[model samples]
Target: MGGGLTLDGLNRQPQIGNTRLQAPIGLAPFNSGMFGQDGSIGTDGLSFYRSFCNDRLGLLCVGGLAVAAAGRANRSSMCLDRDERAHGLRLVCETAHAAGVKVAVQIEHAGRQTGPHETGLPSVAATAAPCPVVGGSPSALSLGEISLIVDQFVHTAEIAARAGADLIEVHAAHGYLLSGFLSAATNTRQDRYGGNLERRFRIVHEIVTRAHAAVGHRIGIRINVHEDLPGGMTPDQAIAGLRNLRTKLAYISISGGMYTRARDVIIPRRTLSRALWRDQAATVRTELGVPVMIAGNIDTPELAASLLEHNVSDVVLFGRSLLADPDMLISATTGRQIQPCTDCGQCKYHTKGYPHIYCPFHPTLRPLRSTWKRRRTD
Candidate 1:
């Protein structure tokens, strides 16, 4: 049913300032630190973003490093050594704010996906089962443990605020702890947190409600509108969940596909279409009465503008696209035809321990310089 509105047509009247962005496009908080081998231990990601964009962009959401930290160490580890985590948060806030971008920290827990050798604690999920990718059987969370996890989300939000983050987004997608609970395929719990869709969504509902109360207007969520898996939460179920959380959330960013299988990671040849999530985003925007952000293989400005023109989403979130070119939004808006990401899967492949992220299309390998020059020249 979607057609018309090319990228050039939308770029004819370019939106420059933050005010111009009806549903502002933004950079995703990718885990550059984890991907890079240096372990520099600061908000290098934020610094990189600021250096590239130069305070022009609004709404910069940091990746869920707090969840990564928690997964790397047990929850008690963070409780025991709050200083390091707090320090990390502080750096992220200062860098992003200094850049004039409203910063939001994504909070997550890997659940059964937790690195076994890293954390040592038994990975926990809504049920006892082996993670499809991580290759470890997780223990089903007890009611007490579930409560603890909820509290952990709240505590993390508090920490994010104290560290000066402008907003907090609960990572309820990508088969993380919250997503694990939300998906019927993953969560087989017989208790209140499982069974029907309502119960299955309780974990997310509780976390969002508590997180909103904990952080107020400064909270949002990145959700998987569809798991794209059999026996999992479908587009319809996800829309219901979004409706339920609308009041509690500041914004709802739509994302899908978990890295549990190779097919889920690669699109077109592997999954349905690269724009599968974009269509789902349109459904979400139609159903939910809140702002919606869409992500997933949206590498072209024309595609993004088409989505925006149709009111598919209030915002477009570019993860690998921005990793390739931080000034992608500016370039597109100003009618500059920049090279789009090829989606070769090299970024994901090299991200495991690569020193820096590079685009196969943009062969220079000088991301910072190229990004800064683009913004500076503009």
Candidate 2:
């Protein structure tokens, strides 16, 4: 993302007040393997990003590794092999720190969205219904199961901390496990985890509270301020939930849409629109008195600066933009107007059916470039 400024322009101006973006531009977990259908390893994902960004970027490692088990096949799976996950995280932390950047990891659970073929466990939600995408009926989770899920989240946080993550972003958005409970549309339970916003938010609150107690100051949450679903939590409801966990949360990251149904619409569209939720984030930041980070299609440095200048958000979380160009943050801060992501969604398309994920737009990954080099030698 370019800021329309030359190196001199950035150097001459007063320093950007918030140092959050000065170095730490978050790398989305990218969900390599574990829960994703593609099943790529976190290490491979980290290696690709580290090489591209030269380790001068913060990363939010995606979490879908089950931390609890109910049976043999239900055991928590690791996204990366034990050594690989730890090594990759250490590499990310060391490399980023050397370049003066910070890193965070996002903790998530697929919940009812987990395919039976994928997780080997029956998909369970607050209420039983047909799966949103595959159209299979699901079972309602028992209260005992709910308690286990909370423990799983806490365990995930602990694992993240051990993985050398600087921050822990609870994935309470995108109609995932936590979001399912929060959304009246998705959650129809008669228990404490359902009903009104307060009750609906109990599971998330407990997760955040336990996460904070476990990880202390390095806890945050990425939430969907508006689910964009019928009967889903609105912006106001999201604000209240965040407010309820004010003391427990360090920062609140704002995002929108339902991941299960609107995956394509959510990532590409939101990733490009810089102004999508600036106002909502500002309002949440104001009311909750916590640092707010806004993610969704935010591509350029100028857009990020504008958001901060207007107090719309405290930080910008670049997802696809970073995928397109890992050095995006460097170029933005250094006043270089590098080529921005075209937002063609080719990266997503490339991974749609492949066993291994690669960015077709990434210059280094171009087969033609390799062929050209070989031809030159010939």
Candidate 3:
């Protein structure tokens, strides 16, 4: 491996914080788009993650927890803005921890990707430019506003820590608020928070530094290796930016793309090559000096194992694969037949206003979907 570490087998356990993963495989955070009105995870949300815990995941990342109301990516984005929300969040942690899996709550801010209709606040970003995908002229964040966001991230980290989470994942990918500031394509301010690459990463550096002081190595980060848009965040730029925060992160999850190219890069299709971001992730692990977790079309256990065998990434994160088959980890461990994800658009482009997520190819999920459909109109 890059750090002189060798993976003897795919079943090796990697330690993060006080939890040791059962295996090197983990569940990348997936937002159900079904949070309560205040962005809290209710009983339904707890059940959603609880079901995945029974499947033998090493780490379960509860995702899309907005740091503030103004940062909500959509109407369904969950929040950690209030202390009361920790009750449900703690329940999620307890459920996963009981299943022998560590939990990390993904703290994020959507930036210009959201609008007043969704957050009941004006869209704000690193710049006033309109996002190509979510059309709107967002107000450029002032220096004071930027400082507030950094504080919000710290506050959220405290709540997640108090709620018994093992780790807090800072979301700085997929064209979100922090991602916007890190990219020259989105951030063009002349102040200290912008201009040079170091300046661009200043916001993330500050947040991670402050959060680390509070929670120590309990902080992990997810970031894009490439943003895909012209003039967007590049691999070299991403690596350099991450160099500023690696010491504080427990691990780094490497992913790519933003809202503009979500279909091809973010959710990806069957036509795209498998292990799409493997090379970039490998590069990061080699150069960034931090344990790396990679996701993006890594569908099979064999493929996931190869990435570890070759010293590409420390952990393999499965998004659509686990959704397609919750028993995937069990099958991978026991050499049972693992179900395949057909890359149907049902779980990708179609679940916008839906209350729940279901994989059409999942044998047992069709009836649940039918039940949701019946209730939607009732």
- Most lDDT-accurate candidate: 3
Candidate 3 deviant stretches above 4 angstroms: 1-8, 38-43, 261-263, 349-352, 361-365, 373-378
TM-score of 2: 0.80
| Per-model CA lDDT versus the true structure | 0.64, 0.62, 0.81
Candidates, ranked, lDDT: 3, 1, 2
Query: What lDDT does model 1 reach?
Result: 0.64
Q: For model 1, how does the per-residue alpha-carbon lDDT over 94-162 read when each residue is reduced to its tens digit?
A: 766665656667777877777555475667778888877677777888999888888778887877778
**Model 1 residue 368 lDDT?**
39
Clashing pairs in model 2, backbone N/Cα/C closer than 3 A: 270-296, 270-297, 271-297, 272-297
Cα misplacement distance, residue 293 of candidate 3 (Å):
0.6
Q: Work out the TM-score per prediction.
A: 0.81, 0.80, 0.92
